[model samples]
Target: AVFLTAFMPDCDGPRTRVIEEVPVSDWMDSVVDEEHAPPSVFLGPEFVRRKLYQLTSEEDYTLCQSLARVSSYYVADQQQRPPFSAARYGAVTKVYVIAKQDLAMVEEYQRQMIAGIPVAEVREMADADHMAMLSAPEELAGHLADIANNYT
Candidate 1:
């Protein structure tokens, strides 16, 4: 099984639909400045700090900033594309690993997504935030390994 850690699956819904549903406050900066190239999504450092990660150290915040990118419209368009039927992907063993402490994609929404699309298994890490890869790497890795042992 391909264990998804703090991942929102495609089958849950379209980006447009999900965005509409989620209470995402002023998260995007559509403005194009000299420093920020045209047609880019800008998520400021403060937002990233408060909304994206459970930073245990200063380095985690720095990592968040360094990893930030101008989310491409093409990718957004692709995400906006119609969702695949559950039947199409039902054959594959999907596992959802929920990050309980995530502020960006909160536990309720994660549960809703999981409920939207039935998965083979669901694992959870109570300490992890949206950036579980950084916040709770060992636990995430352990879950992946466990899932792999069962599926692969």
Candidate 2:
């Protein structure tokens, strides 16, 4: 299971919510540009069709149909409580794979949500952006394996 604690894409939430207090167009541009690269590389026509089919197959198309609808509601939702508070698992270990560069902001938000999580390990990679998992998958995977070994 993954607990994502960050600004939500506008497409998933309601409007009139402003998380970063930034202009709507700027945030939209950033999110789209960030995801566009990988899709261009990996998401060919077939992949696009499959993804569209999957979305249409889902019953929640009312929500899905409003694709790219920007909203800051997710931030308010996250701010109200911790990301993992509603998780199904109890007493299960969790690894927070955060970007090294985002440590400051992520930690600040985490502190507001919960304290004393006993970070089992922290892997800091150099020159990695917010999307470190995509930017440095091998390095991230290696770190994850190392963490898993420690538990075993």
Candidate 3:
């Protein structure tokens, strides 16, 4: 599996193990639902573009303006998920593709994740942002194809 600027969990740790705290300001005009064990926030356009789709085109950015969904952060149902054991899911060949321009997760944090999860290989797309498939779709696809051809 290729992780493209995503939430990468260590095989032996929680999903939030390497995640940095997102500041309240970063959430912008979030409409929050406190019904869950922890409140879920719906990201506004400003936050989404700034953090996730910074390098994407106007059309791509516009698509999110209407269809953005609530964030699963701090949700109650998923908090109980256990880590991936070394003998199970972790045994798969993992290839992490780092989006260097990603503002949401950032490259340093991405490297930190690879450090924890023993990946078969690590690739980097220097121009891509967090939403790499949108920002750099062709490059991302090429990388994925390469990984599948060689690694899988």
Candidate 4:
């Protein structure tokens, strides 16, 4: 399993949600409706460019902008759910890919998750952002290929 600058949870008890270390002002550009049940979040273009696709080319970000959608970040469902079984989830070896320029999750928070959930290997890309597939596809693919070759 590979976690590419993604939130990783342990196979233990409750699944702790990743709290955004960024300030409210940082997300002010994005649309967030707290009044809605469970809340709705729409990652605006400017916010996405700065936070998610900072390392990507402007052309690329613009090209993919139309595909973006409004979504909700509800961890309550995950929190209420039971943890994954060690016999299943923990049985698999996990590899984590750290994206240094990821403003969304940030590098420090990524390291913390890795520390919490032990992984077989850890890889990092200094040039990658939150969307490493877009920002650093070649590097991300290289890491994935290496992981697959070694792990599988």
Segments of candidate 3 deviating more than 4 angstroms: 19-26, 37-39
Clashing pairs in 4: none
* Backbone clashes in model 2, listed as residue pairs: 10-69, 10-70
Over 24-116, each residue of candidate 1 has an lDDT whose tens digit, in order, gives 364533332333333355676766777676554578788667877766433355565776566765556788888888777778888887786
Query: TM-scores for all candidates?
Result: 0.76, 0.38, 0.85, 0.85
Candidate 2 TM-score, C-alpha based: 0.38
lDDT accuracy of residue 42 in candidate 1: 62
Per-residue lDDT of model 3, residues 7-82, tens digit only: 7776766655554344556567666676775667787777788888888998888987878887766634444677
Please give the distance, in angstroms, between residue 49's alpha carbon in candidate 2 and its true position after superposition: 24
In candidate 4, position 29 carries an lDDT of 79
User: Candidate 2, which segments miss by more than 4 Å at Cα?
Assistant: 1-26, 30-90, 102-118
Instruction: State model 2's lDDT.
Output: 0.39
Candidate 1: RMSD to truth: 3.9
Ranking by lDDT: 4, 3, 1, 2
The TM-score measured for candidate 4 stands at 0.85
- Comparing 1 with 2 on TM-score, the higher-scoring candidate is 1
* lDDT against the true structure, each candidate: 0.67, 0.39, 0.78, 0.82
